[model samples]
Target: MHVLSRTLIDLYDAAEDVAPNEYPAVVMAVMHRLISFDGALLGCGLDAMEHARIFHRSPLLPSDYAKVYRSDPLACRLRLGLRVPVTCECRRFYVARECAEVKRFYQRHRIARVLLFGDPPAGRLPRRWVALYRGVDAGFTRNERARMEEVWPHVSRGLTANRRRHLERHVARRAGAASALMNRSGMLEAQDTDFRALLAADRLDVADGVMPERVRQCWRAGSTYVGEHLQISLQECGEFIVCTAVPLGCAVKLTPAERIVANLFASGLNHRQISERLGVSQNTARSHIAHAYAKLDVHDKAALANTLALDPSRVKTGRTE
Candidate 1:
């Protein structure tokens, strides 16, 4: 337990430097540091037969994981099916010479023991697994297995943190956006600073970790909701709930003159038409339209129309264009 604690700290330290593409490598490295295994394989898959993304892996991994897995004894005992706490010993899956192909693969790599752990899919998150191998001279012991079990929770938490970082970066690629992971009850699990600031400035409230009624309804209705100053989109990532927020209401604080011009444009009035209606010259009407666009943070008529689609009263009435 004492050493595992240090190992746990080291685990998180390694997690901090892991990029999305290299998550499995970091995880394997942490396991190596803690367990001192020879080599490892980590990956994502729909099932044992469907290998998807290999996170971290040993060159020793057989060319055919599904074939080798099916032939292994422990896998046979489990009917090659995944159950909770997916960890198994090598001897259970294979004891040498049982299956000729697997035996040859194991012999070539000097492998005598294998410790496999599988994680099933959650929501949009896919299934993942890790396997550690040890050579013939030193197979794993009971104490070592227990140590791995003890450290398993930290392992999951660290990996989740890495995956979240990956997801956050993906969300950040969109302009003027921020995201968070919330539970179904509207409890805030984790969020970025951008999202936090948006929630702070809006009328939306997070009381006792639950989202306000209106926002929750919007989040549920169509996986998106547009309010006066904000718009939110939601998706389920595995068991993790992702919410993205973009602030567009800042444009609503346009001055009275600009607001009048923007609303006119929103109403399908051209510069000439607006000019005639307001008793202003065509050039003056055009200038007002330009200033209104700048204030509303819209680049074109389309964007202006979308902004106007939100309730007009949502924004504050007066500010200089």
Candidate 2:
């Protein structure tokens, strides 16, 4: 009992500090103290197992494990939903022909047994699943299964807390901007109220909590997408992506060179200084600034600075003349 209590405490403490990508490995490590396992898989889904996506798999499993699991008969059962914790000896459980591929996978990896635990959906949280695997010939003891059941809730809570902390940190960093956190597969994990509002306001379909295809493309490319309604920027956060969006601003009309020159001018640099810094002629610098002023409709430095400050794509810097 003391060991279980200490392990739970340590899991929560580690969750508070580890990145979202690192949390799974931490959970697996902590679980090893309670149940002897060679590998583990952690995943979550909304409503049904068919939609379940694997977020983490133990290093012991091959890189292709996730791709193979998706089509396995066991995965099909998971699609139905996991109502309680269950243990299975792979060789005995996966005897059917349909489970042949998964069996081959397990045999190749030497995963002899697995214990599955599920955290059903509650309120805003999605359903979560964890599977611990063992390579030894012996099955898990009843006490070990009980220990897993007791610790499963804490594991689920730690995952939720870790995701919340990561999203909150990104939201804080991008203050006043609508933002969301999504898995690499483009599923929305956590989003700010403003982020949803921005999507709705732009009429971007977020059907079933999946980001729009355009946003997913930008996320995959690690680039920014500037549209007529909103400007979306992507930032990589370990195994997840942080997307920040803002309503379109006029500054987007400025050419790259003009934007750079405008920023230099707004920062109090004279045309000669801007020209020298950018290796352009003073006349060229003046020309770019004039074009920027016209495009942004800003007559002077103060207005230009204010306009640039409001530019969602502006790269804020401490550069000075």
Q: In candidate 1, what are the lDDT values of residues 1-321, reduced to their tens digit?
A: 576677788778766776644655666666776676776665444233433233334433534655576665544433343443344334444554367766666666666677665643332233345667776556666666666666655776777676567566556456667787664556554566577668666677653345567877876776576665677788766544678887755344565666776777777889888777777788887887788777666899888877767743544322233
| lDDT, candidates in the order shown | 0.62, 0.75
Which 10-residue span in candidate 1 carries the lowest summed lDDT?
46-55
Q: In model 1, which regions exceed 4 Å deviation?
A: 46-62, 73-98, 120-125, 173-321
| TM of each candidate vs. truth | 0.46, 0.66
Model 2: per-residue lDDT, tens digit, 1-321? 598889898899987798888788788888888888766767665333333333334354634566577766666565665566678888887785666778888888778888887765442444567777778878989998888878888888888788878988865555556888877667677777778778776678765567888888887777897765678888887778888887766556777788788888898999998877888899998999899888777798899999998776797533334
Cα deviation in Å at residue 172, candidate 1?
3.0
Candidate 2 is scored at a TM of 0.66
- In model 1, what is the error at residue 45, expressed in angstroms? 2.9
Task: Give the CA lDDT, 0 to 100, for residue 59 in model 1.
Answer: 38
